[model samples]
Target: MIRTVVLDIGETLTRDDRYWASWGDWLGIPRHTLSALVGAVVVHGRDNADAIRLLRPDIDISAEYAAREAAGLGERLDETDLYEDVRPALAALRAAGVRVVIAGNQSARMGELLRALALPADLVVTSGEWGVAKPARAFFEHVLAVSECAAEATLYVGDHPVNDIHPARAAGLRTAHLRRGPWGHWWADDPAVRVAADWSINSLAELPDIVKAQE
Candidate 1:
């Protein structure tokens, strides 16, 4: 039985295209240029932080976030930013007595942001809190420990093919490749990565049915 479902934040639960574009503007880079950097990072199998460093060697990520927070831009996620299917899917899962967790490779304020947005999750976690990030075995192990459930009885949903799907599957959890964001649309045709996910979903509306089937 799939007792727990852990979700990725960026492209899976929330849409951040505009937010990233704003960040690009703040950094004096064209949004398209910043987007290209993001695509390049995924294509080259590089980490997002490494790509940011390559783009701006002098910028400290923490300081940048602090600046944004001071400007009342960071640490805020509005309900409109979420995908349309997210709330309904989460509600269904929760109503069915499944534990839902929002655990992602996010900053320290992720839990706060989720709470501020009033997202329906039983627990929220971040790499900053856990001291490890996704695509790492330790991160998935930590998730399993926190969920207090066996890996085989858990499901992880995310937009990344390599970072999210592959690692979670390797860690013995079922994975659903949510095909909506950059990673999903870009890597959708990659046969190797495509085969790694136990399921591929274009919408979170499809999730409850998938969970039901599992049960």
Candidate 2:
């Protein structure tokens, strides 16, 4: 039985358009230029941060992130940033007596912003708060701890295949690949994603039914 549902943030919950656009402005790069580079990096299986590194080869990512924050141009989260189906899907899961957890590779500040929005979930956390990121064993260990359920009984949903699908499946949690964002669309048809995720969906609205069916 799927007793818990854990979701990733970017693209799965919120679109990264504002985040990237802000970064582009901070870096003094045109929006289209940075976006194309980001897509190129994703296609090559590189980290999204690498897109910045490609444009500014000597930039220190963490330092630049801090600089952005110090300048008051850091991570911005508001209601409109989230996908339309997120709230409804999370609510349905909770109504069905399922534990909902939101955990993703986001900064601690972003975590605070997310919590401020008071999303419909039992727990909300991020890799930055845990001091570890996804595709790492420690990250999944944190997830399992927060889930309070056997890995097999938890369903992890995210857009990225490598970070969400492969690792979550390997860690023994059931996974759903959400085809809603750049990474999602890029890798959705990959055989690896198909093999890794227990379910592949295009919308969060489908999640409650998926959970119910498993039960």
Every model: Cα RMSD to truth: 1.9, 0.7
Could you tell me which residue pairs clash in candidate 2? none
Candidate 2 lDDT over residue span 1-215, tens digit each: 99999999999999999989998999899999999999999999999999999999999988989888898888889999999999999999999999999999999998999999998999999999999999898999999999999999999999998889899999999999999888999999999889888999999999999988987
What is the C-alpha lDDT profile of model 1 across 78-126, one tens digit per residue?
7888989989999999888889998998878866777677777898888
Of candidate 1, the 10-residue stretch with the lowest lDDT total is: 45-54
Clashing pairs in 1: none
Q: Give me the runs in candidate 2 sitting further than 4 Å from their true place.
A: none
Estimated TM-score per prediction?
0.91, 0.99
lDDT of each: 0.84, 0.94
